[model samples]
Target chain A: MASSPTTLRLAVCLFDQVTALDYQGPIEILGFLDPNNVKPDVPTPSYLLEITYLARTLEPIKATAGPRALADRTYDEVGDGEQFDLILVPGGQGARPEKVPSSLLEFLKRQAPGAKHVLSVCTGSWILARAGLLQGKKATTNKSVFKAVVENIHGYGIDWIPKARFVVNDDKKIWTSSGVTAGMDMANAFLEYLVGKEAALRIRGIVELSAKEEGDDEFAEYYHLL
Target chain B: MASSPTTLRLAVCLFDQVTALDYQGPIEILGFLDPNNVKPDVPTPSYLLEITYLARTLEPIKATAGPRALADRTYDEVGDGEQFDLILVPGGQGARPEKVPSSLLEFLKRQAPGAKHVLSVCTGSWILARAGLLQGKKATTNKSVFKAVVENIHGYGIDWIPKARFVVNDDKKIWTSSGVTAGMDMANAFLEYLVGKEAALRIRGIVELSAKEEGDDEFAEYYHLL
Candidate 1:
């Protein structure tokens, strides 16, 4: 049997103080689809999940931990209307600054227009909010920062959907999740959507993600109490 | 108000497959001594918690997540007869290998002689066992690998304490915990030992880890049945 075509471009936006796990969780899961690991029955025998750290420049981005991660490409490098299959924004202290860099906001706005899917982990949604991409959209973030996201960003109508641990809004084009660790959960959900439930489950088993969508209700209950 | 003489030298060991959260959970709490946020009265100013990765060489260690984390120093560089206040080993697939590298095992054995306290997260106890440090000692690892740690290693007399969620044989200078995520709990337990319960609670509050330790019983009840 002939192997299926591999074509999925995933660009993860990175900046100072980007939560390392947020970007790592998704990248690890997707990168595991190496050609060597492809099963015969899989439609996409070897899915090319190309991950790039979309930044303003190729400078080293400092993570929450002291280590600095180098970016693969700049915003302009992938410019000229090149469409990506998925665009991910990670959240951390970096997202809470008083002023969102205009270049970053413009880059995000432009990326959101043509990407097949736009996702945010924790306060990464704040970036989308500043870019005017989350207007009237249901979203979530680090529970502590939820109020900040809602009260601070103007003209970005955000319906704080506290019930869903992670919310997929506006027809799956926009996805947002809660806290630093939930990035893995969000990635698993997206994998389930892109591939199938079984593939997602297989990946989850490999990664040992203890919490699932079902447990989201428990998280919601805790969130309410908090 | 001279700061109390620094007593503890906390070294978070890094190697292939080291879980980031395992090291981060304790380091975040111990490294930052922000008393204003948690407890005002506690006089436990942050000690000199030196975070370093103990690797065979100066080469960057590959974490399970694929990113290369550079170590500050190699095991050999620490010099002969150097004593550590505490040594932390994190769990991951790297620790589960049939044969622990001779260099690593030698380093662990040598270091164990002078360490004031030793802690292991998830399967990190296996590395301790390979060094003959767990002989005649009670310890635990991630529930999945506990049995292997007991039965697989030869001439290592471990009690294989099964009931406790996390085991600390203070007499034996050994601390072990379950699974990848339990590093946080183990770290908290260590802090409680060194700085007292009040200090531990304060750090836990800052990290938002106030929840009760998720014991092995809960893990078995949920996942083992499935």
Candidate 2:
């Protein structure tokens, strides 16, 4: 049954003071798609995901929330020749600052254009926006920092939605989700789109995520983002 | 607020090929309680939690799913006197083998008893059981590996529940959850129990977790574990 073999290259951007859940939520829900994470008895046939953790530096950087992660490659190393199919940028207190890292912004600006899909969780969109990539793009951000993001990124000419758990630009294939846990919801939906509803549901069943929905979030109302 | 001071020490155990989400989900949810993660505008009044990551070796260990993390301390370094208020053990492909490392089992055996709360996510319960910790206790494991867990650890006399997302022996303060994302749900419930519903709800609102519930799991039916 195997026909043409393809490898999906995913770049998970890491940085100092990153939020653990924003990136982790998406990685957890979607990480299984990495063919390397296979079940021995289940007969998955084959694996197709090739993940690389990219950061500005090679050193281990601690997130503001907790947990220090080591990047597999630096942005400069993955600079020119290498390109990705998917780029996932997760936000946190680090992204909350007005002066975001130049290297990070430059990396996103450089690599995101060539990728098939550019996804951001929470404030990561702010990074993409700072890179000038989200200009004329529809996106959303963490509600806890709702006003801050809405206020800060207005200069980029991006259309920021107030009440979405996530927003997608069908034309650009750029997906952005609200706060920490909301990324998981968005990821579950993205998985449904990437593989098929049946496969996504199969994954949700294993994780026991019965209540995850595409737009079933309440933070917009709770935080008065709407 | 200045009248009294208190600190809660938490120890998160890490291992080779550990699932990043399993450890990260709980860390993300609970990391906020660690006073250092305070928001200046939020006025949390004061900080009170200290976290330490413990592993068999000080070197970075790669999660079976993805991401490499650094442990704060080696298990040998965190000797008998260094007790913790909470101990979290997350499971992964690493825990599936019959012969897990003796040091990790030894560390859990030595440290968990002294903790106010001992929690395991997904197959981490298997490690707790393997350490001879969950005997005569109610617990659960990853539904995908349900038969493996039920078959492997039956001799330990654990009351393995098939349907619950998470099960806790209130008196013992032992909490165990199903697979992967179930850890986030368990963490939300635990936050509610720890800091009161209002505070937990506040945290949940920030993260925008809509479907995180203690018993809101469906893996048993999906996996045919029941």
Candidate 3:
């Protein structure tokens, strides 16, 4: 018998001061791509895309975006046997190394084993690093905060890949992007992976977003000339 | 005689689908405050503040928070002669209203009279509202769209208010708050002019938010009962 198509379960982590765009950009894209919203003219196959705000507890988490956002369930709500197709960690001021709660770190550690893909935006990589997930993975962050991430964290064996606008370090099942807006770029890439580039491109056209390459080739070419 | 510390001229106008809470609520309080964020540690001085977002223009505007916002400024700019202490507008999805160009609205209006106050949060309220003197309006944004403000538009509005639970609608002589946050509750009754006791108290504590009181007790009891 043919195996049933796997449903994509995406959990976006949230906390106080979390940058609004970090989640909003990707969320909006995902929400738009949702089969429910697809116009009759568009051909979208049925895909169970479940996006949830994974918080530490059931309490409503405040977002940098004006109103508070409530999570569908707490980190503890998901059982050990449960698996997620993707785990998206959005960055913000709240993702500071010192401020990330232990509960969140523990949740990250527990979920990593089952997550088919672990993605992060901007400083969100910091939290994954805290969870010991980025030890050997290549990652990136906001350009301004790049230096601090390199100097502040020690002995992780992680490849500090600066210069690249965004990096896909598939070896660790981790994908990272620079700054907050780039989260949409990364999400688009992931969407291409799930629904094929054509569908992702269609969504991009609908949203009026420009296509962005994953790595920084212009800088690399400039440095080579020198 | 000194003219009472020069009235902090503040304005927050209405627009269609404009997140009513975003503009009205914040402007209400900022107009009532002393401009220093100085409260008596108690909510008592909820009596003095003057702010307005009058539709000086006939331009149809859009808000990022929801739908369209109407502009009060009839002229291209808030005339060079009339300097305002502070000027603001809110954001909604209306920023992209049909046949309306809010950016043009923002571009034409000059800052009130002098180096008056200028502010906005969430979307391009700062860019589209046309608050003059934004060249140096120490400001923070909704975090998600800060880049659009900082990069797409030039000049300062950049003293990022990190601690502000909302935007501070601050201009040389004015202040703004982030759109749709608790700032609305604070704006409605606590800003410059006092809003009666019961209404003010109802919005302040976040409690009794749903409790509806139709007119005053005497009016309801005596008139309705009869």
Top candidate on TM-score is 2
Q: Model 3 scores what on Cα lDDT?
A: 0.54
Tens-digit per-residue lDDT, A82-185, candidate 2: 88988999998788556456788888888888888888998998888888888888999888887888787777888888888788787748999988877878
Listed in order, each prediction's TM-score against the native is 0.77, 0.93, 0.52
Candidate 3, CAPRI quality class derived from DockQ: incorrect
lDDT of 1: 0.65
Q: Can you tell me which runs of candidate 2 are displaced by over 4 Å?
A: A40-47, A97-99, B1-5, B40-47
Return the interface RMSD of the candidates, in order shown, one decimal each.
Answer: 4.5, 1.6, 18.6
Cα lDDT tens digits, model 1, B1-226, are 6666364666667776665555554555555442222245445554546555567666666665434556667777776757676888876767766534566777777777788788887778888887788888887776655556667775777877655557878573788876655565666777776667876765554334433353533453323422
TM-score (0 to 1) for chain A, all models?
A: 0.87, 0.92, 0.88
Best-to-worst ranking by TM-score: 2, 1, 3
Between 1 and 2, whose lDDT is larger?
A: 2
| Chain B only, TM-score of each candidate | 0.84, 0.92, 0.49
Residue-by-residue lDDT tens digits, candidate 3, B76-121: 4455566555555555444433523453365335454443444453
Task: For candidate 1, write residues A79-135 as lDDT tens digits.
Answer: 765877788887767777563455677788777788888988878888888888888
lDDT of 2 by residue, B1-226 (tens): 3543257788888888787788788888788787776544332523356889888888888787657888888888876767888888899878875545678898888888777888899899999998888889999888888888889887888999888888888684899988988888788888777766776777777777774566666778778866
Relative to the real complex, the DockQ score for model 1 comes to: 0.21
Ordering by lDDT: 2, 1, 3
Docking class of 1: incorrect
Model 3 stretches with alpha carbons more than 4 Å out = A1-6, A217-226, B1-226
